[model samples]
Structure formats: C-alpha cells, structure tokens
Target: MTKSTQGFCFHTATSSHVEPLPNAKKAMAILRAAGMKKINFAGGEPFMNAEFLGQLVMYCKETLNLESVSVVTNGSKVTKRWLAKYGEYPDIMAISCDSFDETTNVKIGRGTGNHLKTVVELSQKCKEHGIMLKINTVVNRYNFHEDMNAAIEEIQPFRWKCFQVLIVPEENGSEHTLRDARRFLISDDEWRLFNEKHRHQECFVPEGNDVMASSYLLLDEYLRFLNKGWESRQKVF
Candidate 1:
C-alpha cells in the first residue's frame, strides 16, 4: 500500500563483483529526478563498498527526498557502525537466508556455518538502531522440507519474504550464476507443501513462480532493468 521502488539491482546469491558499479551518484540523482519513489541499495553485497553504499542511502533519503530507501543484503557485512551511520536512511533491510540446518545450508551454498546466527545478530542490531528487519528465504530442494517457523519467530523480522528458487534462463540458469540451479530446483507440490506449513505466520509474504514471472522492475548490475524477467536485460540510459 505504501510507495515503493520499480527497479533495483542485486545478486540473488553471493556476488563475484567486488568492485562497485559505476555512476552511482548520477544514477540516484537521475532516478530521483525522474520521479522514482524509493531507491533500494542492493547488489553483489552493497556493503562490499560500505562507504559508497552509505553515501547512496543517505543521498536517496536526504538529497533526493525519496519516500523510502531499502537494501537487500546477505547480512554478513551489515554492521553496527553501518547501521549507526546510515540507519535512518533505509526503511527496510532484507537479509537472505534459506535454511536453518548447518549441513543443508552448506549444501545450499548459503554459507559454511551458523548462517542463522549471524542473521539473528544482524536482526538485533537493526532493532537497536531503530531499523525494520526483513528476512528473505529462497525455497529450494535443499531447504523445502526444513521448517523455518522457529527461526522466523526467533528473529522477529518485520517481514518474512518467502520466494521460490527463481530460475531465470538468462541468469540463474546461465553461466553467470553463483550456484547451480539444477541442484536447487524444487517441484510445485514441494513448494506448496512448504507454503502450507508456514503461510500462517503473520510475517509471511509469499512470492510464487507465476507472480515472479509476471513482472518486476529489477535492475541488473549495470543498472539496466531486467525487463523480460531473467531471459534478457534492457538498458534505460
């Protein structure tokens, strides 16, 4: 119901691009001047270049006067200092976490150890800093059966966004993906069962394959809108 972004750029998995993207300030200014409402700072890990990320977040909220600013992060780089420095900027901080089991998480390539623990710590920091915490989980073959209600209850995120392991032919299924989609793909029945199990949670926000395919104003690493979903990307400049 609130005003939100039409496009954003972020990696669905751990990012390989260590260097920050080009013309970030100019991009923010352009989007703002174009009447864009919210600017979400995301990507191969926005915090990889924390200084630049902080600048964009501040600029969107302060200079651009955008309605909301948000970020999609892996939670490892979100720190107390980061939240303290730019806490007021982002209206939401979404952390990607897929599984609760250590072994399953490793298989899912989310991380090697205690991914949930780190997410929980970040949640606390967000709470302390007066920021809204959102938990994002991608349902895949590896984690579809694992019940996440306990972990969700523990983190107490303002929102829990559940997504199907999105298979984009030109993206996750392409050569650029961080992990193999073959190993992660799950059946519709499996996804349905998983949803039926946790859909009752107050924070639950479901995004299925049809909904995913319908439309999203997602910007690629180059700031181009991935207009045709995952199959192709388009340049706005």
Candidate 2:
C-alpha cells in the first residue's frame, strides 16, 4: 500500500501544556521533501490564536500552493461572521460535537454546554459561505450507545461525519492511570459493530497518515518565533 500522508496539529502556547510545533515542522519538512500536498490543522482550540491562524492559512495557500487546507475545532469561540471571513480561505472544516445532549456535552467538553447547537449552527453558516463542513464525534464508554446514534442522526445532513474512538493522549498528567490505551480505548471490533449498525450512511475512520509540506513550514516558523529547543520532548503515543 502507498504510505499515508503526514499532517500536524497546532495549539497555542499560552495555555494547555505540551508544544508540538517543533515535531510538526520536522514532519512538514519531510512531507514537502517527499512532494506531498494537503494539510490539516487541529488543536486544543485553533481559534484561540486568530492572528496566527490567519497567517498560517495564508502561508499554506501562498507558499505551499496547497490544494486542501482543513481545521478541526471545537465551536466554542468562533462566530458566524468569523467563519464567513475565513471560510473562503480554508477548504474544509471539521467541528467536534461529542454529544447531542447538553448535560453530557458539558461533561465531555468541560463546561462547554450547547456545543452541539453551536456546531450545527456553524455548519449551516459554513454551507452558506461555500465551505464544506464535517462533524467529528469521539465515542467512548460514557456516551457510546446513545451518542453515536445522536451524532449520525444530527450530522447526516452535512457533507461528512467522522466517528473516532477515544484516545487519551499521554499528556495532561493522567499517564499513570491511562497507561493501557486499550482499556479506555475502543476496539476495532466495536468500530465494526458501529459501522454495521449505521450502514445506512457512510462513516469513516480518519486517515491521519496524510502529510502536508506546509505543516513543516508552520512548525519552523513557530519555533523560530519562539526560539526554544523542543527536540527532546516525549511522543504522545
């Protein structure tokens, strides 16, 4: 099989620990050298750095000549006007909506209730501005049964919906109890079952292998701006 594309995730340095800018840049350079295209920006919340994001998007379009640029975000901070402004610049958007229920959503999103509503509204707004909208749902033990159905039902009208099993990354100081990735993680068997039950529509396991050369450029730019050594950091896996 052909190798997967490389992509990078970006987050602000102000809060929420673990900086991956260095690694991301390195990956970007590798992808670019290999003549790769397409880039995706994901984060703790990308909208947190509005100015940086705008510059990054522009750089991807101009410097890398990338055909596809996407951002995955939690629709807590963005508005319809802000989306309208950037909608033309970026090619696609994937908004995270874990649960349709407000109470469960608050628990999963940590005080961000009404995220489903916000994301739905944002999706509609994106459609108006000629942007493709995708919904991302993290299925886990807590909301697996009902949440999956809810997500499929609500997001079917949209262009795409990505259902992913929960992956508790090795950051945020919960490593001790979260040692077993399989314990809290969903199995491939579970995914198969979910797929069979939701056969009426097409759902996909995101191919995180896609690499974009611009990601490396973004990483290099971010590191040069900060002037720090992040070469020895631990991997999230």
Candidate 3:
C-alpha cells in the first residue's frame, strides 16, 4: 500500500475554471501527509496556472524533499525557459502525443499543424537539460491499428514512452462517450497480441500501486481531487 513499492500514486484537485477550492499548498500538504514524495501536476492543462505551478514545484522540492516531480502537458503553453526551470527542479515532463502526423494530431483534438513538432523540440530541450521526458499516448480504435508502431518510432529516442488502453467510466458524467469508448476498447487478448507484436521493445505496465488513475495527482492553481470514481475501478490486466 506504500507508494514507492506499490508503483506510483496520483492525487487530483479541481480546476480554477470549474470551482473555487484550496490552493496547491493545501493539496501538497495532503499528498505529503499521504506519504507521497513523487508527484505529478495534471489538469484541463497544468500550464494554465504557470506561476502557481512554479511555486508548487519549488515548495515540493525544498519543503517536502521530494524524490521526483512530473507534469502531464499538452506542449502548447510551455516555453523553453519554463521547461528548463522545470527540469532544474528535477521534474519529469510527460507530453500527451496521440500521433506524430499533424493532420491526424489536429483531427483528434490535440491542435493544428506543428504541435507534435513543438513537443519533439521541447522533448529534445528537456533531454539537453537532463530532465526525464516521457510521451504518453492514448490508444484508440482509429489510431490503434496502424499508428502504434509509427508513434513508437517517433518517440523511441526519448527517455520514456507509454501507451494506455482507453477506459470508459460508466458514470453519467464521464467525458468518454460509448462511441469513443468502443473505438479504443480492445480485449485483454487483443492487448496481449499487441504487446507480443511489439515485445521487442520495453513496455511499462503501471506499477502494482501506481495505476495512472491512482498514483498521480491533478489540481488547478487551487488543488483538489477532480475524479473520485477512479479509486474504485477493478484492477487492470
């Protein structure tokens, strides 16, 4: 049940646009109390609250004596200096990249042309500064069949790359629709086959305790746990 041996742990907070709540300081206190040292900042997008994020990073590094820190980003709102500063604090940067192809990237709601390019460039910058970089891809039916290998190839040079099977929450407020869910839903057998096909490369299954939904924490400038149902899901295969 402890975090490190269990894998990773996640905490969530409400976004500024969504509601008013406790700030990042309170959120960090809660996480520290839970015995978490490594933390991640996720949101509608973390960069929206740049100053607050910078403060949080500084506080966690100095006050909590954290071992590692990370942010899951979209790559659009970050600057080279911000990335560099984030790197200095020993934080890992994981950018959400569904495809390396621009048209496909935009079609999937990521953004217009050169978004992936920007991410690639930023990732390189992160490497130059010795910050860990990870590419996070959400595999779905449209892009799952053919693009997986190419996505891997595009991101292979980075420090880490991860593929997550899309999960649809049954709850009414879930952002995922049944149609979107169906597009990405693969059976465990299919997942095994996909793994086998790409078995030549290293792949990471979420550590026993570090399930993405569980191990990391997300907040607005004011931190809060956004999704509560995630903690109750059955174990992923």
Candidate 4:
C-alpha cells in the first residue's frame, strides 16, 4: 500500500526530447492539481543526472510542498556529496538489490561485483542524513532461492519490498525489447515460496503480479499514462 501513495516516472525517457526542468515543473503542477501529494522518481537510473534529480526533489518539497518525495535507484551512481546537498528533500531512498549474493546480483545486471557493497554504503549515508532507507528486491529466476535475511538484517531498512518478476507485453516480454524478461519470470508458486521464506522478517513486504498490476499509476518518458495490462500509454500530455 505504501507504493500506491506515489506516482512513478522515468526521468531519462522524458528528458531526452524535452527541456527537463520546465517539463518537470509542468508535470509536477499537473500532479499537484490532480491532488497527488507524493511522487517517486525512478529510472533509467535517476542519479545519472544527480543535480537535476536533486532539483526536482527540492521543488516537490519546498515549492509544491508535497507530502512525500522518494527516489528509486540502483545505488551505483549515488555519492556522499550529493546526499549531503539533497538528501534532506527526499523522504525515502529505495535501493534495488535483487540478491544478497554479489555473483547473482552481477548476473542479474544490478551492477558489477560490488552492488551489494554499494547498497550497504548508501544505506549508511541515508541514515546519517536522516533519510529513510528502503530496499527493493525483484524475485526473478536467478534470485528466487536466495536467503537475503542476513544481509537485510544487517542493513536494517525501514522497508524491504520484494516484487515478483513481471513481464509487460511491449516492455520486457518480447524478444524485440531491450530486456527479454521471459527468462527472468518466476511462477506463482515460486513467488509464494519466496515470500514464505522471508515471512519472519519484520520489514519484508511481498508483492505479486496481481497486486502490482493494478496498484501503480505510471507515467512513461513521454509523460503518457501507462497501465501494466493490455493498454499501453492510455493518455499523453
């Protein structure tokens, strides 16, 4: 339910063809007008343009006075200096760590061999800056059986979310797409098993396809509304 509180956007997809700042302001105004009080910035790795992302976070809190502003990142590009400058704006910083094992993480394309290390470091920095830390794990074929309890316990995030691997029709399901996530997808039983394994963790929250399908109101790079089902880009700005 925490996810439904915010709308998500792909920053790089929109930034490619438009002036990011103005477009961002317009989008934020529209969202605010629509009574959206919380917004989350996702990628194309938002931290790629750290300053731009920081500005948007600041504008949401200071200018629009949004109730919550969050960022979902891979944690590879985040730096201590950037956190010091802009960390105060975001209410939560969620790092994607698919697996606790470094080898499995690298194979899943989270980062190189050091992604787990980066996540740990970023979690510490977020704590020092008084920002809530969250971990997002996608339970795909490669990481379905991993026991992440020890690492998650060590990090002690405010929330630890596990998502069943979903394959959108035009996005990641087909061979033509950049990611053929068909191979990564796990069965419903596998997802249930994975959740059962971590049920003891206090912070753990598991989301299956049925829940994820209708929960999000996503805006794509072109500022078009996206639904995870048969409809793609239901509305455009």
Candidate 5:
C-alpha cells in the first residue's frame, strides 16, 4: 500500500493540557543531522504554542535546509500575521477538515461550529502567502454520505487527502484510549462508494487503513520514535 509519510512527523502532544517538549531547537539539530528531508509538526494544536512553532518551522527551513517543513493544524488559530511571519519556511500547510456543515462538525467532535468558515478563510490566506494548502478529511459515518464536491471545488486545495477513519486495535478494541470511534466505522464498500464520487477530482488523494495504520514514521512528544498510531509500541528514543 502507499504511505503518506516521506520523512519526519513530529507529534508534540495529544491534548492542550500536555506540556510541550523542551529544547526544540536541539531536537531540530538532531533531526537535521539524521538527514531528514521532510518534516511535519503536529499537536493537540501546534499553533497553541505559536512562538515555538514558528521558530521551529524557521529552524527546519533555514538552518536544517530541509526540502520541506510543514504543519498539520485544525485551522482554528491561524491568522494572517502568523502565516506572514512563518509562512515563508514551510512548503505545505495542511488543515484537518472533516465536514462542511457546521452542526456536523460539532457532532463529530471535529469542532464546535463555523469550522468550514475558518478553513475557507485560511485557504485564501494560504494562497495569498504562497503556501501550498492541503486539506485532510477523515471519512466516517457522520460524513460518509455528505457530498463535499462543491466545497472542495471552491477551495481548490493543492492536495485533498481523504482518509478512511481508522480504528486501531489497541485503541478501539479494549476501550483504553478511543475505542468509541467504532460507532463511526464504515465498511470497505461504503468507503469505495464515497471515493467513487470524488475519484474524478484531480487533487484527490485517498488512504485506507493499511496506509494509515503503520506506514508513517511518528515521533512522540518526548521525541521518541513510535511504531505508529493508537496501537503503537516500542518507543525508540
């Protein structure tokens, strides 16, 4: 199967309450020494730590000289000044947008409301700033049947990623982390039907469980290399 990862993906933390790692600049030096060509900074919301996030992005682009430095954000705290100050470094700015409707987003725990509005504005800012904008959509029972063709066409992101909602064995099986997601699970046939509609879109990119499960290299908040998502084991520091 194909993978979404080409280089490094740094997951700062899972929630806003979790403290960020110390010595970010030093970590970048280590990654640069390891010859990382691409880097992605993710978090409960990386923008929550705006100052550090901006500096780290610059470090990757200017000092490490990585081929690409990008961030995966929820598009809530994005602002023109934030983009202007740190936009020049990253090659792609990705946003996680699941539903186009306001209520649907709240129901799915993606956001409170007005998510699509924020995304739309951010899309324009990305274009204005010359940053390649990408949207990552996690398909689930909530949004499986909704037709997003019109909205997608309007935004015209450089790349549109559609992922089949993932339920890891360690997560959705026992009930420790996030097994409740099982309520929103969909079958292969259901996913294919959804994909068939947008398959014609030139920018559409699709990923099934196989790709999302363990294909990418993920670094945890402590800068430890985790095996993969939810079911991750064997943390290599």
Candidate 6:
C-alpha cells in the first residue's frame, strides 16, 4: 500500500495525538489478511511522530512479517539515533531530493538550506543500518533544468525514481491546500527531456502524470482509501 498513513507535518493537519495506535495496528492486520505484502508509509512526514511510525514499521516487519516495508521522507527530521533503533525493520528508506542544488531545493519548498546535506547523511545511515536507499525526485519547473546525475550517483541509491510534478486540485493545486503547486507544473515535453537526460543511469525510473495517477493504492491519514479523480481524491475505502 502506498501512502499507508496520511498525516504529514507540512501538508495536512494530521495530529499525532488523534491517531489511535490500536486502530492502526488493527488496520495492519486487515491489510495483511488481504494479502498485502509490501507497505510504504508516506503522505506526511512519517518522522513527525517518530515513535508512532517506528511502532508501525516494527509491527509490519516483526509481527506481520510483511515482505518489504518502506517509508518516504524529505530527510530533514530523520536522525541517526532513530535509524539506530528501527532501521533494521525497514527494508528501504526512500528520501525525496528534487534537486542537488540547495537553492533549488529551497525554491521547490522541500526544506531549508541543508536539504541535500540531510539526504546525504540519511542515505549513509541507511546504508550502515542495512536499509536499501532509494531517491525520489519530483521534476518540476524549479528543478527540471538541473542535472542530478552526480548527486544521485554519490548517494548510490538502489533506485532513483523521478516523477513529473502532478497537480491535483485539492491536494497541491488549490488554495485550500497547504501548498499551491500550479507554478511548478511542467509540460510533457519537458518531463520527457528530463528523463532522457538521465536515462543513462541504470537506476533511473521515471513516471509521468498518467502512470503516477493510476499506479498505487493511496490511503489518507484517516486510513480512508483515496481514489483518483480529475481534481481530488473523492472516494473512501
């Protein structure tokens, strides 16, 4: 399941206090019973409530015996200590790094000055802890022109997934959301060009809007299944 948990610090108003651990554990059991083997935690910054996220990760691996468990993060809030404790449980740690350039990353609203540095440090820690690293890049207006080959090679992630910046009405394109991402939208040709430039990398995996739209089973913070619509996610589990 992609976006297995939806509370993110920067995107949604997901309160850690409101999510019941017992209910979440029950949800995991349901997924396991349904034959779901791999689960990825995304939607909001998983580290916002490190304890909660760690518990879920450990449960998926140790108790549920899921084939693979992963989490995607912006790499700022991750700490070495956290990895030391729970890293063994996660099969992969995918860090979002849109651009290697710090300025470009800041412009893209990824984080402050040290975004790249944080990703590098986190990648190293994941390596030490035996968690395979993956790099996720969103190709947008601010970063489509930049070359990320060197930085990605340096990090040496097992996979380098690049995506065309997608604009969903209520998600990132509307005023009601935390981020208005229309300005970041790029043309199909631009997206293709970005992929073409980096196609030489054996690890490169690019996904455009259409492929990204229908690819995954997305769940919100409330554990409601999110269905893709022209504008927003309109359905429930």
Q: Write the per-residue lDDT of candidate 4 for residues 197-230, one digit (tens) a residue.
A: 9989999999988998788777765566764555
Sequence-dependent TM-score of model 1: 0.84
- For each candidate, give its TM-score against the true structure: 0.84, 0.66, 0.71, 0.89, 0.85, 0.88
The residue pairs that clash in candidate 5, if any, are 172-179
Off by over 4 Å in 2: 1-31, 147-154, 157-169, 172-183, 203-237
Task: Compare the candidates by TM-score and give the number of the best one.
Answer: 4
What's the lDDT for residue 217 in model 2?
34
Better of 1 and 4 by lDDT: 4
lDDT of 4 at 124: 81
Q: What would the per-residue lDDT of candidate 5 be over residues 1-237, giving only the tens digit for each residue? A: 011121111221233342244556676777678767888887657787787788889988998899988888878888778887988888898998888988877777666677888898888888888999999888888888888899999999989999988765443434454334667788998899889989999999999888887666666555556534444444332
**Candidates ranked by TM-score, best first?**
4, 6, 5, 1, 3, 2
Q: What is the C-alpha RMSD of each candidate to the true structure, in Å?
A: 5.5, 8.2, 7.5, 4.8, 5.4, 3.8
Show pairs that collide, candidate 2.
5-209, 5-210, 5-211, 6-210, 6-211, 28-216
Q: Candidate 3: what lDDT?
A: 0.55
Q: Which 10 consecutive positions of candidate 5 have the poorest summed lDDT?
A: 1-10
> Each model's number of backbone clashes?
1, 6, 17, 0, 1, 1
- Per-residue alpha-carbon lDDT of model 3 for 1-237, expressed as tens digits? 001110011222121452222345665766788788788766546677665666677788877888987777776777777755665774687877766677766656666677777787767777777777777665444444443565566656444344544342432123442123333455655555655555555643322112644654443232333444556433111
Full-model lDDT, candidate 6 = 0.78
Q: State the TM-score for model 5.
A: 0.85
Candidate 6 per-residue C-alpha lDDT over 40-126 given as tens digits, one digit per residue, 9 for 90 to 100: 997557887788889999999999999999999877778878887898899999988888888877777667778877888888788
| Model 6: how far residue 105 lies from native, Å | 0.8
Per-residue alpha-carbon lDDT of candidate 2 for residues 50-101, written as tens digits (9 for 90 to 100): 6556556656666667788777777666666676566677778788665677
